[model samples]
Target: MRIGITSPVVTAVPGVHSPWERGAGIEELGAVAEAADRLGFHHLTCSEHVAVPADVAEQRGGTYWDPLATFGYLAARTRHIRFATQVLVLGYHHPLAVAKRYGTLDRISGGRLVLGLGVGSLEEEFQLLGAAFEGRGAVADDALAALRASLSRREPAHHGEHFDYAGFVVEPHAVQERVPLWIGGRTPRSLRRAVAHGDGWVPFGLPLDRLREMVGAASLPEGFEVVLSAGRPLDPSGDSDGTAKALRGVSEAGATLVSVSLAAESAGHYLEQLEALTRIADAVAAEEGAA
Candidate 1:
């Protein structure tokens, strides 16, 4: 069972670590990354959001360090831990530019990049970025196809509805001929997208029962992985077993990766919460060994 922590974004904070709080600067973010590396976290992931909605606006801070730049900083600071974006809002980025960036990060991190993607839900953000809001899903599909083609060959070519080019190749190709691509979202359409194109599924808003149902219906390829991380309520008293139960449920539902999220008030507070989760990971590891 591999265990990892969500990045120290303000969304992970309970209250006091709002984007306005300035609680964790770049330096502290680096410290948090180093701590995860030392603590045996398998992968460190960050969410991408240009703006926050009213539904989440007050609960989570409205701003975040761009995930790619932050991961580049982390890649320089850590050695073994993998770097990933929980979901990078694929439609918002040009495929060629994104391909180049991830390719560079993959090389620098020795091929430890996992590019999770989504078609984002915020129309306001789309308007802000000057992207066609209504066409995002179709554009995202095209982008994914282009990305797949661009990353497969030594010198790749692509001509798509949203993006077009020929005789184009990204230098510093990913360590893996094709880097891992995980798709996230909980709707049936999203699940279908995952089964059709994604290497993994990360549904973040479904209940355990529903998650199992979706897993059964998804009909994802054999060996295709699932990562369970719904930003829902967590039992505070579960101690170490709280995470274990979640992970066990995910495993039974066919998930191969389990991630735990910590909610706190600041970087220090979040680190304190991580200690509690680490204790759980240690206990889980012990139980597996004993069994």
Candidate 2:
């Protein structure tokens, strides 16, 4: 299975993020991006949250780096590693807007963009954005359809239940003929949505057994990627065997791509873990090659 960095410093979750991330800025983030690009990590992810509620911020990780700005900078710095949104809340923006903006980004990045989208769960955020909270899932479904019809086309057009547009010209549309779309959620319905409207499913907050059951039950199409997490942050620098086992276990759990999280205490320490994990990944690949 291909491995991608879960990406640090971009979102400083209270318990999961390193303490050093609180003070780090784009410089540090860029450094990590450059290193990740050079080290052969398949992709680097950044999630979106315009504003998190103060009450939920503590638990949900208040500091969400804007994926567009972050990816734009990282794109300029990196050569090949893809930029994934981990998820951009679909209810927050118009499909054509997404197509236009990310299409420009795809053009700039030479088509190294993996669009991750979600229907969004926070009702308050939906209200804050003046977006429809009721029947949002259905709207999101339509939006996904519109997006599918729109992305990568200059004169894109679509007619859906909630959204209908035509004759709009989007210059510098996505470079890739078909940009990869990954739906994000942690439920069976989310899996179905991904199957119907996206290229992959990225579920979070589920145990390995639950994930395995859901994946086994689903009718995933050919080339439909299931991206499972590498579980807890891996301490490959301290426990190489444990790290290797966790990585392999994620692959065995039916993941076509694994989101590898590294445990570290500081920025420097994080880079060390990144390097260590890369070495472990390389060794794993070599071992598989020899076998």
> By TM-score, who's the top model here?
2
Least well predicted 10-residue stretch by lDDT in candidate 1 = 230-239
Candidate 2, 63-181: lDDT as tens digits: 88889989999999999999998999899999999999999999999999999999899999999999999998999999999999999999999998899999989998998999999
Model 1 per-residue lDDT at 31: 75
Reference-based lDDT, residue 223, model 1: 70
Error of 1 at 237 (Å): 9.8
List model 1 lDDT by residue over 1-291, tens digit each. Answer: 676667765244344333423555777778778888887788888778886666766665566667778888899999888887888998689987878888888888888898889988888788888878897889988888888887635576888888888876568667677788888888988778777877888887678889888887766787787887624334323444565676566666766777766555566656666666677667666776788
**Residue pairs with backbone atoms closer than 3 Å in model 1 (clashes):** none
Error of 1 at 161 (Å): 2.9
TM per candidate comes to 0.86, 0.97
Model 2, stretches more than 4 Å misplaced? 286-291
**lDDT minimum window of 10 residues, candidate 2:** 12-21
Q: Could you tell me which residue pairs clash in candidate 2?
A: none
After TM-score superposition, the amount by which residue 154's alpha carbon in candidate 1 deviates from its true location, in angstroms, is 4.7
